[model samples]
Target: MRVAALDDDVEELDLIKSTLRAIGHDCHVFTEGAALQRELRRETFDLLIFDWHLPDTTRPEIVQWVRNHLQARIPILFVTNRRQERDLVEGLAAGADDFMMKPIRVGELAARAIGNLLGNALKFSREGAWITCAVEALGVDWPVRVEDEGPGIDEALQAQLFEPCVRGRSGTQVDGAGLGLAFVRTVAQRHGGKVLLDSAPGRGSAFRLVLAQAPDAPPPERGQGEAPA
Candidate 1:
């Protein structure tokens, strides 16, 4: 896939480009928004990797400009450190396809890009250790389910569901710094969807990422991947 990485940070740009190139992707690095827009006007890329903050512009403005002005529908993947709900929504509203945080590893980025291209959902197992995933969004109604036999969530945990540094007190080690819910929310919203949470003290929590269809998502490959285990 051909990718466009827009950021003012040179190191980040290099890291993204090099990592993407290493993973069988062609990347075009951009240091400014104007040059990116100029190129955008001239050609189409398979995917976009952008940042929330640029040298002189905001991501939402650029996203809106691209969505409103451009005729093609290109999938966008945001690599940002901002975790504020408002920031997430703004990016989603700006026409970004997804948002990831800083301090990210290259493998996760590749999985996300590959998943979006192939129409997949990336998640973790109940243990939160393995990368359990599924392809081709489920064609069911809203209020889906993510029920499992793992540790159940509580009200406090629900409030901190998508936040970082949250853990359950069942004595089992919970992995991650709380990037899952945030990532899930970002992915769901970008596809015109929402994430539903229903957790019990003993029963496992069911996180339903309810989403509407994208206007022009590529045809989904038949079921071949597994959901978060």
Candidate 2:
């Protein structure tokens, strides 16, 4: 998962970055809230981890910006020393999905971050997180296939997978505009090709994009008396 972590303490931020990296997550750390906000405008993250008392901004302000201005559904997890009942309630009210106390355990942090992104395959992927892409001859055409070992899309959702703005019920909590498959379909159709999905629940998914191969170019003409080189 791609994650953004905000903390003013340099040591804490480094620990967060190293810990997340060890668990196969990419982390972008920021020392100030403004820098984090600036990055938020330019990129998308699967999760956001913020310290409650940032130097330039408060937790409430950042949460409001994410919920109101950005209007993003990206899950947020807060890390702070605020252990009071009121503090927890206020953070939750500000749109944080979960919170952790200071002096975090690396294992627990990794688990929580993964859980927020997706549930099972994301957190405990036994395949060790890999995607395979290949192009193979299919009759006179070539089919490019991308396969992932993540949880498969539901059979019912597969029918509308390429439709714009349509998201599977299982992925409604995921952060996306649901245009990826739609764009893929458009590109495949433009190339006199089609897209296919072969998947079943818990069996993973493979997306095949088949495109007709261009006809072979005619052999170059040679003079009648030309000698072989």
Candidate 3:
């Protein structure tokens, strides 16, 4: 795939380009927003990797420009240090396809790009398929569960479900890069958490990411109304 990466940090730009290149992707690196915008006007790309903060502009502004001016549907993958719920919501609202925090993991970045593409594909093909996500307190642990009503995994494939490049039998007909689950597992483990899966053929799947919470943490405050989309 041809990818365009934009970041102000030289080291980060080099790392991103090198990583993408190692995986056989042709990457064009940019250190400023204006240069990227100019390139976008003259060239097309399969994917875009961006950092939230740049020397001249912010991610939201660039995202807005892409959405409103360029009017392109190219998948965007954000690689940045802004790791907050509101920040994520803002990025998604501004039309980014995926977001990853700083200290990039090349393998996970590839997997995320694949996951975003696969998710869009699934949305179009799977009738009545939907996802349910929730965050719940499990004693001193908080488990985030993402349940999908798509075709479930077969029993034989359950054992290595989280292994890299191991896609379930149900996904054979679906196009994917087969690294989504593995990346999920990696993120969970890195946070001193564990990933749990429950599924059977014809039964939907549920993945619970159990992360530790501080013992004395206060309960979450209820909001007044629905937040912005």
lDDT of 3 by residue, 164-201 (tens): 55654565475444556665665556556777878766
Q: TM-scores of all models?
A: 0.49, 0.50, 0.52
Please give the CA lDDT of all the candidate structures.
0.61, 0.67, 0.68
Expressed as tens digits, the lDDT of each residue in 70-183 for candidate 1 is 886677778788889998888787777778888875335434533432231222224342232334455542323434444555676577655423445233554433334555
Tens-place lDDT digits, model 2, residues 1-229: 5789998899988998997676456799999888988899999887788888777888888988888857568778888887899999999998898788887643343334223223323322344665555545656666656665666788898898776556553432554545446546655565577778887767666677665555672322322121111
Candidates sorted by lDDT, best first: 3, 2, 1
Among all candidates shown, the one with the greatest TM-score: 3
Report the C-alpha displacement of residue 201, candidate 2, in angstroms.
5.8
Evaluated at residue 52, the lDDT of candidate 3 is 82
Candidate ranking (TM-score, best to worst)? 3, 2, 1
Q: In model 2, where do residues sit more than 4 Å from their true spots?
A: 105-229
The Cα error of candidate 1 at residue 91, in Å, is 1.3
Which runs in model 3 stand beyond 4 Å of their true positions? 105-229
